[model samples]
Structures are given as C-alpha cells and as structure tokens.
Target: MKYILGIDGGGSKTTAILADETGKILGKGRGGASNYQTIGLENAGQAIKFAAAAAVEQAAENLSVSWADLEGSVAVVAGLAGADRPQDRERLRAALLAQMPVNPIGLRVEHDALVALAAATGNKPGIILIAGTGSIAFGIDRNGRQVRAGGWGPILGDEGSGYFIGRAALTAVLWEYDGRGKPTSLTKRITSYLQVTQPDEIVPLVYQGPLQRPEIARLAEIVLEEAAGGDEVSCRIIADAADHLVKLISAVLSRLDWCEPGIPAAGTGGLLQPENMLWTNIAKALAGTHPQVVFAPPMLPPELGAVLLGREMLDTAVGQEEFIANLRWSIEETSQS
Candidate 1:
C-alpha cells in the first residue's frame, strides 16, 4: 500500500494526515507553528517533522508500516501559510524533506489559501475568501488560472480581517476621545479592552508596546458585540469590513471565466460566522453585486484538501471518484476519533 502525506501548516498550528493512495485514513497528528516567517526556518522545519513523525507513529500502531518504513509514500503536499512565493515554497519543501521519515516520489508546497479553496471547491472552479489573522481571496478558474487580492499583512493589506476590524474600532475610540468622532459605547469598552482608563493611553500600548497582531484581533469580538447592541461606530466599522471583503470577492470573480454570470465562493475564517454582523452585511451586499454567486462555508477542512491535492499528483489518476468519497467519509471518523 503506497502512502501519501498531507499537511496543513500555519502560524498557529500544524496538522498532518497519513493516508494510502486509495484514500484510506491511517493516522493523524499535530504540531506547533510552521510559518517560517514568524518562527524561523529551523523551528518551522522541526515542527513539520514532529507532526509528520507523530502521524507516522499512529500509522505504525494501525498498519504494517512503521516510521522507518515510510519511505514508500507516493507523494506529499504541504499547504503552508507564508509560503507564498515559489522560492519560499522550495525552501519549505526542503524544510519538510530534511530529516523526515518519508521520501515521497512527488512533493509539492502550496499556499494555505489554495488548500482552503481546494477544500471549499473540491478542486473544482471556485474562489475562497479567508479572513483570519490575515486576509486573502484566491480563485481557480475552470482552466486552472489563479488570481488573488489582499493578503498584504497587517500594515499594507489584510482588509476585512480581524486585525483590520479591531484596529478600526480602537482608532475610532481614540477619535472619540479627542472629540473628532461621535461618542460611542466602544470608547469605554475598548478602553477596558486595552486596560487603560483613558483612551489616549492606548497610543504607547499600540504603537511602541505590546498588542501584537493576534492580540489586536481579539478586539474584533468586542466590536461585533457592540455592533449587535446598536453601537453606531461599531456598526459602521463592521459595514466597512464587510465592504472590503465583498470587494475582495468581486475582484476575484470579475477576473475569472464566470465573471458575467457569477461563480461559487465560500467563506473561511473567524469573523465569517453566520450569526455575526460581518456575515450578514457581506451577504446583503453580495446579493446586489453578484446574484448568481452561491456563498457558503468551506466544503472540507484544509488537511483533507491537502490530501486531495496530493492525490492529484499520482501517475495513473484512476479511482479519483472512490478516493474522494472515501476521503470524505473517513474524515468524519477521524474527527470523531
């Protein structure tokens, strides 16, 4: 039985899955962050190997193969965050290959968003809008042409992201303090969130001090709450976030083949909850802009998407239908286990 290794790695965590070419679920494992940009190459490499080893360890318990014998893997697909450029992808490929148990025949490294879109579209033609710690809209047309917008990180881009929503509220709070903006309840709440009595004191904490990107993203929840409670400032910020995200989806859709009528698009990330203000605002806006677009949640998780992509690299490419069905069915068991 030939094995395939599929990895979904990001700044926060890493998940690795072991499956046969037939899509049989063998084992699963997790490790720390593998984003080389944040954790550095050595640490990211170690994290990838650790996750792979743990998966192989579980596979050793369930199958005939052990860690040392994993060289029979047919392919490996690692969909990693921060590995955007081809050079970065090559670097990550090396990182995953070094001191690893498996010596797969085919190895590929892809950006995390691509894997998310694959999961959403089942490798069909579609677009994925991811607004987590960062934001990016990536699409694959029927002809395999790919296009992306946003995802420039906290400073330059990441429009419609948690960090973007969070920063906008905090900035509004400061403006309110200076009497430049309307008085809103977020001033008090955001001040408390920042742990400062006066809103002006947030300057040092935000500019020259702590409040990392993730830390700032936490404030987005507060903004969401305030918007639900009818806070004008918070409501406006949420609307702006929705507008940015809608534009991202529109930008990708316009460049693709189905631009005239519309196409499939899915939402993936923290702020995209169905019950939330952001989701509603974006949905309403899209109803007018692109009526034929069917927006929904991701069809599958990214690791399974990585699995599908790995399956694509096989030589014969037969039994694809069975492979997808079994993979989907096995994911339920894996999740329950």
Candidate 2:
C-alpha cells in the first residue's frame, strides 16, 4: 500500500506523521530542532531524519509490514524553517533525502509558515499569524497570490514572537537593575527564573552560557504569568506584542487586498492562545479596525497540514468534512498515547 509522510521542522522541534492515501494517520514521531539557520544544515538534517525514521518505523510496526515494503511508495512533504530561499530549500531537500532509509516516490519542501497557513485555512485563501519562538504572517488570496511579512528571525525581526517578548523582558529587567527604568516585578521574576542571584548575572548566562533561542523564548511564559498577576511592565510588554502581531496581520491583509468584509483569518503558535491577554488584545485591536474579518481557530496543526499537502501532491483529495473529522480524532489519539 502507498503511504505519505508529512514533516513540520521548526526551531524548537520536528514532528513527522505517517498517513495513508485516504488521510488516515498511522504513526507520529518527534525530534529536536531542525531550523537549519539556527542549528546548521547537518544538525537540521539529522533531526528531520530521526523524526521521519521513527514515524515510518512506527507505521510499519502498526500495519505489520516490513520497513522496506513501506519505503518506495511513500511521498514526502516537508515544511521546514529556514527554507525561505530556493537554494536553502534545495540544500535542505538534498540533506533530508540523503538521510532517508529508502527512496520515496517524490519530495516537496516549503517554508514552515506556508504549512501553518495551510493548517489554519485548510489550503483555502486566508491569512495566518504565527507567533511562536518566532513570528510571521502569511496569506493566500483566491487568485493563488501569496504575501508574507515579518519572518526575519530574532536578530532581524520576529517582533511579536516569544524571543521578542523574552528579550524585551530581559532588557526591562536590566534597565530596572541599573536604575534607568522603573522598578518592576520582572526584575525579581526574571532573576529568579534564570536562577541568578542578581540581574547582572544574566549577561554572562546569555552571552557565555549555553542559552539557546528556545531557552530565551521560554522566558516569555514568565512574562505572561507576571502580566496575568497584574504586573504593569509585563502587561505593557504583552500589549506591545499584541500590537506587533496586529500590524503583521494588517500588512498581509493589505497586500492580499483582503481588507473587505468576511475574509477568513486565523492564528497559530504559543502567543495566540485564546486564554492569554496577548490573544485577547490582538483580537480586540483587529476587530476595531477590520470589523468584517472572521478570525477562525486553526483547523489542524502544521504537521497534519503537511500531510494534507502531501495528499494533494499525490493527487488525492483531503480536507473533506469526514476526512477532517477522522484526522482530528487520529491526532488526539496519537497525542494522548
């Protein structure tokens, strides 16, 4: 039987799923960071290989088939971070193929944001605002036109991302420590979170220690928690994050000519949680400006969206109501198990 593999390769982790032609999920696997730009090409390739092999092995086990039997018929679709340029995509594709256990029918690689957008709208024309460890806004119009804004990574952009918020919190803490800014709870909270006795210690920990991007990004949780507790500085940070995200969405919308009423838009990533002030403020801001916009929740995670795209590549139709329902059930079951 023919099989398909879908991969979501990100800065924090890599996820791979194995599914049949009809969109029935069979197995899932996860591994460490795969953003080639952050981790280097060899490391990213290893992560993708590790995750894909695990998924394929698990599917072979479940179906009582030999691994070799499952290999030749599989179609691979990967949505990888840091694959923005055609050369980057080609390099990553070659690296991933080199690590595969068996030759597959075909392989396709795309930027991670495209898959996030696909997952948000099920390949329909809509906008997706993703604010995880990094942030980007991508949209596709009815005419198959695509536009994007603000995925320049931490050093260049990622304005509303976890890294952005965390770096801001750290800056605020440092300012407060030096008496240049008002004393805020973040000064205490950040020092404690970093296990440093004094705020100045953060300098060495960030610069000399093994502090990675995701580690710094994790500090955004502390900012959120403090904001929830009514810390003024933390609240302002989150509000600023919301404003940045709104601007990203608005820019994409303008590029897509989607300023009219009833354009479907959705959000994905850590900051877009409905329970958080970040998301609430973003929703309010967007509504005030674009009242007719329909803000929908994501229909599927990016990994599953990769699978959907893989199916499409195989000339198979997915995203029908029943198929989506089954896919959702399969995802929940796999996640729980």
Candidate 3:
C-alpha cells in the first residue's frame, strides 16, 4: 500500500499525519517542539524523527501494517513556524533527511505561514494571516503568485502575534510597577500568573534560560482581561496590536491587488481561536481598509493545512467531506491518547 506523511512543526509542538493514497487518514502522532529557531538545528532532526516515528507506529498498529511494508511516501510537506530564512529551510530539510530513513520519494519544507494559506484556500486563491508565536501574512494572488509579509520573528517583527502582545504586556507591567505608566491590572495579573509577587522576578525568568513562546504568550490573556475590565492601557495595547495585525493583511492584499469584491481572507493560529477579540479587531480593521474583502473562518487547524497541502502537491484532490473527516479522526485519536 502507498502512503504519504505530512507534518506541521510549530514552535510549541509538532503534528504528524499518515494518509493513504486516496487521502484517507490512517493515523497521526504528536511530538515535541520542532521550531528550528527554538530547538536549534542540532535537535530539529531528532524532533522530526520522534514525531514522525510516533505517527508511523500508531498507523502501523491501527491499520495492522508493517513499517517495512509502508511504501515510499510522497510530498511530505512540513510547515514550520521559524523556517522563514532560506538558511532555516535548508537546515530543516537537511535535518529531516539526516534523521529519517532514506525513502525513494521526497520531503518538502515550507513556511508555516504558507501552509496556513494553502489550508485556508486549498488550491484556490486566497489570503491567510497567522497570529501565534509570530505573525505573518501569506497569499496566492489571482495570477498564482505567492506573497508574504511580516514573518520576521518576535525580536524584530512578529507584530500582532501572541508573543508580541505578551511582550508588550510584560513591558507595560514593568512600566506600571516603575510608576512610569498608569496602574493597570496587568501589573498584578502578570506577576500572579508567573507565581511571583513582583515584576523583578520575571527578569530572571525571561532572561535566565530558554524563553517559551507559549508561556510568554499567556500574558496576552492578561492583557485582554485587563482590557475587558475597562483598563484603558490594556485597550490601547490591544487596539495597537489589532492595527499591527492589519498591516500584515494589508501587505498581502496590496500584492494580490484584488480588483473586485469577494476576495477571501482568513485568520488562523493562537490569535484566531474562538472568542478571541484580537481576531475580531483584526477583521474589523481589515474591513475598514478593504471594503470588498471577504472573510472565511478557517475550517481546520493550520497544521491540517500542511497535511492537505502535502496531498495537493501530488496533484490529488481531497474532497471537503473526506478532508474534514481525516481532521476529525486525527483530533479524536489524539484526544483519546
């Protein structure tokens, strides 16, 4: 039997999907963080191996198939969060090959942003804005050209992302504590969330060791909470974040140059989770800029977009029902585990 493997390697975690030639999913696996930037090139290969092996083993057990019999897989696309630079992609690809057993078929690595884009629109044209550890806008214009904006990472860019917002909140907390800014609830909430009584405690945590993206991003919730409770400081921060996020879409839309109404744009990642006001604000801002732009709620997680895009790379058509069913199966299986 033939098979294809698709992987989505995020900053926090990695997902692996095993599917048959016809797009029927056999199994999937969850593994440790595979962001090359976070985990380093030396460890990326191991991370991918662990994640891929877990999925392969699960699929083997569930389908009663042997690893040796697993035919050469095709188009093993990996959409990674930090594979922005050409060097990063090269490193990730090299790492995948070095770690995995040699297969006759090949693997393809791409920006996590592009995978999210493909996931949102399938083979059709559309735009995808992802706000997670980082923020980036990716789209396929009507002419089939791909354009990307603002995936420069948290240090320099990543505006409107959870990490950015979190960092902003943390700074604000320090500001409030120093009497440089108005007293806001974030000053207390952030300290409490980290189990500390003061901002000084976080200085060591943020600088001492490896800073976790999601952990830092958790502060974004505090920012949102303070804003919800009517803190003007928090509101202004969120509003600014929303504005920064709009810039991502605007950059992509400018490249796409949509001359007509009904061009689809979708939101994804941590910021777009249900009930997320950050995402709502972004949509509202986009509306103000492009009155005719259409918004499609992301139907599947961006990782699943990596899987589906892998299938598409083979020139295969995955029907909506089957695609969603595969996603449901993966989610259910993961949940049970």
Query: By how many angstroms RMSD does model 3 differ from the true structure?
Result: 2.7
Candidate 1 lDDT by residue in tens digits, 113-225: 99989888787889999988788899999889888988888889999999999999889998898889998899989888778999889888877889878888889999999
Candidate 1 clashing pairs, residues 3+ apart or interchain: none
Per-model lDDT: 0.85, 0.86, 0.76
Extract clashing residue pairs from model 2.
none
* lDDT of candidate 3 at residue 5, scale 0 to 100: 77
By the TM-score metric, which is better: model 1 or model 3? 1
Model 2 lDDT tens row, 1-337: 6778899999889999988877788888899999999899999989998898788778877875445876678889999989998999999989888888888889999999888888778777898899998999998988888899999988899998999999999999999989887778998888887889998999998899966778888889999989999999999999999999999988988888555688888988986787588988888998899786787678898788888777666655645565667778888987787
lDDT computed for candidate 2 = 0.86
Error of 3 at 266 (Å): 1.6
Residue 280 shift from truth in candidate 2, angstroms: 0.3
RMSD after Cα superposition, model 1? 2.2
Off by over 4 Å in 1: 62-65, 260-262, 315-318
TM-scores, each model vs. reference: 0.91, 0.93, 0.88
Residue 306 shift from truth in candidate 1, angstroms: 0.6
User: lDDT score, residue 7, model 2?
Assistant: 95
What count of clashes does model 1 give?
0
